[model samples]
Target: MDFENFLKKLKEKDRVTLSKVITLVDNETKEGVEFLKKFYKERKDSFRIGITGPPGVGKSTLLNKLIERFAKKYDSVSVVAVDPSSPFTGGAILGDRLRMENIYKFDNVYMRSVASRGSLGGLSSSTENILQVLEIFGTDVIFVETVGVGQSELDVMEITDLVIVTLVPESGDSIQAMKAGIMEIGDIFVINKSDREDAYRVSEYVKSILQMKYQDKELTPPVINVSAKNDTNIDELVSRIENLKEIFIQKGIIERKREIRRKKEVREILRDMFIKSIDRELKIIENKNDKDVSPYEISEKILKNIDFKSLEDIWKER
Candidate 1:
């Protein structure tokens, strides 16, 4: 089907078209860029949740349980699972779905695995764009699972309304989560694999850290213990998520968060366009006759000759 038909079917909740649209956006072809340039009305109230943490913390399993719980309350749910990319080929194994096989059986749940593609923030380059499409497609609740790259995955914050950072008992993740950047971003912390002996200890550790970090603040993130495999406390986790949504609404923080996200998206789009425009100059500098040119010097030269309007025009054309 053509782009228009695909978009029409996507709005009609056609799963096949939704999957194709994600792929088209990922491809970043001229057609895909054109489609992205088309504006779609935003759904202001849809819940966007982010789940992130270290690998082996059972983020996928936790998400599966969350999907089951969310499905009971919402008619449609979508997931963007960001998996690590292959360093050699820049391709993704897309293995998050392997553990979430049962979730695929739910017609209301639409899951897409995205390769991180060397993005520093643990999300794919096209994640925000794909999320815009999903929002326009009328998904009631959207969940984003990051590449599990630890603290630096804050890019998830740009798109998700609530960020849930998952940690396991034995992985030293509890302490790691308390480190500078990571602890502050979490709206909720989940100690998964709660069946483990040290689960409560980890939960307490997280809670204490939060208490210390936010003692002066009005809103402190809640810590919950749950076993994704055993389905323990999953309902409580979902309840916390729902409650947080209300808090965000009552405090009018949602609008501020959306504003921040809009600014971030605009900055990213401009950065990408600038980098694309500089590609030829960068290549020329790389093949320069003077091998002694420093990286900083080449960068300075590129910026000295960069044309802002030309780059803007190129971006517009794309």
Candidate 2:
């Protein structure tokens, strides 16, 4: 479709349109990449929630229930399910693909599933692009569910307004949470599948971990318990998320989040531009090389000859 028509479609449609926009952004085409740069500058707000844990922590189930609540109250939601499981000759298993089918009927809930594909951070690098598209689409709430994340990917925090870690009882996750790593990133800790034997113990473990690791900050993350299958404590979980938003407002976290999002969009535009420039220049050099130029020889020339300062200046322009 033409750019104006596409823009109209994007502003009007649901998650499906957002999904298409992300796919276009991922393509790195001349028009596609340029459109995203403009689109990102135009779209500025989406309340992001990150639901992450190991594979079977009931995140999908909880998110399904959570979406039900959002649908009733909000205009729309954007969900990105990042499934990092090994491929069946390369395919997502039960994690993002099949699990999300539980909430597929909700018209207001727009879902996109992304195979993790050995992404090092337990999240795709292009996730920011997907999120920007959703923000432009006017989704009131955006949820990104990672199959898992390690200590390294604070990148998830870069885009999230709230980071909610979902855990089940007796999963050895308590110790994992306490190791001076994941605890700091959590805005909310959820003990899902609380019907299990050590559920309360897990809750206590989370509380203990928080008590041990908290800084002098007044807004400490809360440990919430919920059983998604039975729909127990679901309302409280919803309230807790709202509570986090209120806290965000009070603590100026909303502004902090906005600043981060602005920087992210700017960087993404520059990165995509550099990629295109590098690709095109290398191809031109290769076409000109009649003799057998070594790959390193051409690569070094490309690196040495390109005006990085000019590229940087281009990025700085509005």
RMSD of 2: 4.9
| Alpha-carbon local distance difference test for all models | 0.80, 0.74
Best by TM-score: 1
- RMSD (Å) of each candidate, 1 decimal: 2.4, 4.9
Q: Write the per-residue lDDT of candidate 1 for residues 1-318, one digit (tens) a residue.
A: 376786678778888877777788787777666666663553335679999887788999999888888887789988988877777888667888877865767889988878878775477788887887788678999999985565345788778898998988885554774467667788999989989898898788888888988864547999999999999999999988988899898898888999898898889887898888787567777666867878788788778888888877767676
lDDT of 2: 0.74
Per-residue lDDT of candidate 2, residues 1-318 (tens digit): 576667788777744556667787544345656777676666757789988766678888888888888888888887888766464455555345465654667788888877655455466666777787777777889998875557323656676888887878866555574455566777888888888888998788778878777775556788888899899999999998998798898989888887877787688656767975676576777668457878788788778888987666544452
Against the correct fold, how does model 2 do in TM-score?
0.80
